[model samples]
Target: MNASPQFRVLRSRATETHNNLREEILAALESIIFESYHNSFTIRADLEVAFAAEVQSKFAVAAHSGTMSLFLALRACDIGPGDEVITVANSDISTTGAISQCGAIPVLCDVLANDYTINTDLVERSITDKTRAIMPVDMHGHPANVKALRPLADHYNLRIVEDAALAAGACDYGLPVGAFADVTVFSFSPFKPLGSSGNGAMLVTNDEEICDKLRLLVGYGHDPLRHGVKDGYQNYTAEGYNVPLDALEAAVLSVKLPYLKEWTAKRRAIVAALQDGLAGAPARLPSFRPESAPTFRSYMICVDRQFEIYQGLRAAGIEAAFSYAPPIYQYSVYAGAFPNSNELKVTDRLAKELVNLPITPEFSDSDVEYMIETTKDLLEKT
Candidate 1:
């Protein structure tokens, strides 16, 4: 017998918080059933409060999904058609989806060779009079050099709506990822670092005007009236999305919120070990920026013969995988809907070469060692 446990990437489960998530959810249901003051919406409000406090942001808008938050953020910044939003291609289609949703064009940029983040230099040059925003994804929980993008954005009179979907609780320059951008979005999908029971997301910002618009837009434009109401239930002032955070999900996330930092610390420790084990190997580890602290939602490596290695990992009962397989622009669904200048050489190469390693907080020491050894063994054979 091998006597080693399987190392699968992204086998996420519920947070093992001492508090009962079930009870919190039931309390929310009770509020709804009993018709308490402010109704069950209090649960959603509480969750937003906890998340905002955790990230140290003045305002937080509970959203249905990370993509919806992005959509809202784009509108909050007044980015619309005929406007261009610069972003990298090596991310989920949702990164570009937000831009398209706002009737704006997503100008794809390349990424860094070492770290796999947005190539700030290329992003700077891509800016033009039509450029409205820069949406940089903190890929693999690593904060893209966002601080560098801020100065560049200021110079160009552009806005920044960060894709922080994978970077919950991540920090850069002594602050969380959401702290630096004009509006930052996060996901609480079951698999991310800080997750909810079901799908949930948030948009955090310090700007009151953006905050007001986000709240209204998520609720079908109720706050700032732009039009009229339907029936007697839902209303809308401006044409907006019905992307509210459900009460049950909010309750579940609220219970799990307190333990996020501890969980993040555990994940960071595992990443440190992986870095040590893979030192001077054929593979390249995470390309973390200086003074930035990222929660390891997942670990990635740049290696050769990516598919062969992926097959080897799968054959060994490892659940290793890669992302975007098509790097957004190349996705069959988009199929030339977005424009690219072939400057994404790094992004294109990484899409084919990078692999995500199993390194969740759920992983055990044995799991970590097994993955390290398995990877080394596979590399040797390759």
Candidate 2:
């Protein structure tokens, strides 16, 4: 059997980029190791500046990870035990975990079949007296229907915390993803659209009060006046947690932030090529609207016999797998907890059919073509 061209070409280029990025990371480590900072404030300020420039927000807070970012944002908004947060079940488990950590109930909602984002009508219907917030995840670098969601939130007096972990450069109409929500959380994990060598995360908000509260919550609730404490006896104002991003990781993330726009363009180009090549294939390509621009963090498709296709791609030396199979609600931890867990029809269908293909910046035109051809062949032959 002849190996697919994607196996021979795509993997090599991705490995090359990985090696080069590792060297650049080492050089950054060497530089930061010698720099002297007067206090932790300096590092925080640098991150704030970098984030503010990228998201066009006045306030940004650095967190230990994307999960923590969501937790802090929820906490700052006063969402705690007994509160219900409406969100989709077709997202990474991190979002659900964060909600549970804050002692809030996660109300699982179904996603649209076309875009794979939370259904706005379902979200509106899920609201109740206990509903305090709605967390819409931007799945696969595409923004959810935040414009419609904003109005619904205002109607119900609910807070909107956008999980934009996959959407670094994603924009809807003319507005960026972060600009539409009350609070937006972004991830800097190794697999995100704009990732660091290690874990880091950011929270962006235009609300000063929320930003101030989040800062205090992440910094042990220490009053600014107690910056210089004597004899290790400092007064703590409120209960909080230690969730600060490492300075070294922040430095590396700052380096990659500048190239995000170019990288996003490349991903879109590749998705377009794949769509065109597989126009008549049996597999279903992602459905993106004309008004939105997705960063294409992962090129995903839904099809029958998804498991067979997954194994076929692997045998062909193409790394493909289910993105979020066995939806979050099906996990043992959330088995009977989430409300409406039994009614997630679309979510259940997607969990069984979604397959994520490699769509990194390193993939070439031939790599995309081979993916389309191989996928078609597998679907037909099976």
Model 1, runs deviating above 4 Å = 1-10, 15-39, 224-236, 340-342
RMSD of 1: 3.9
TM-score for candidate 1, please give it. 0.90
- Total colliding residue pairs, candidate 2: 0
Q: What is the lDDT of residue 221 in candidate 1?
A: 70
Q: Which sections of candidate 2 miss by over 4 Å?
A: 1-15, 18-27, 37-44, 223-233, 340-342
Query: Can you write out model 2's per-residue Cα lDDT over 259-367, one digit (the tens) per residue?
Result: 7888889888988888887788787887877777788888888889888988888788787767777888778987678754438898899888988777778777777
Model 1: pairs clashing at backbone N, Cα or C within 3 Å = 226-237, 227-237
Give the per-residue lDDT digits (tens) of candidate 1, residues 59-172. 998999997888889999999988999998888888898898889999988889877888888887787789989999998888888888989888888889999999997899
Clashes of each: 2, 0
Candidate 1 local distance difference test against the native = 0.81
lDDT of each: 0.81, 0.81
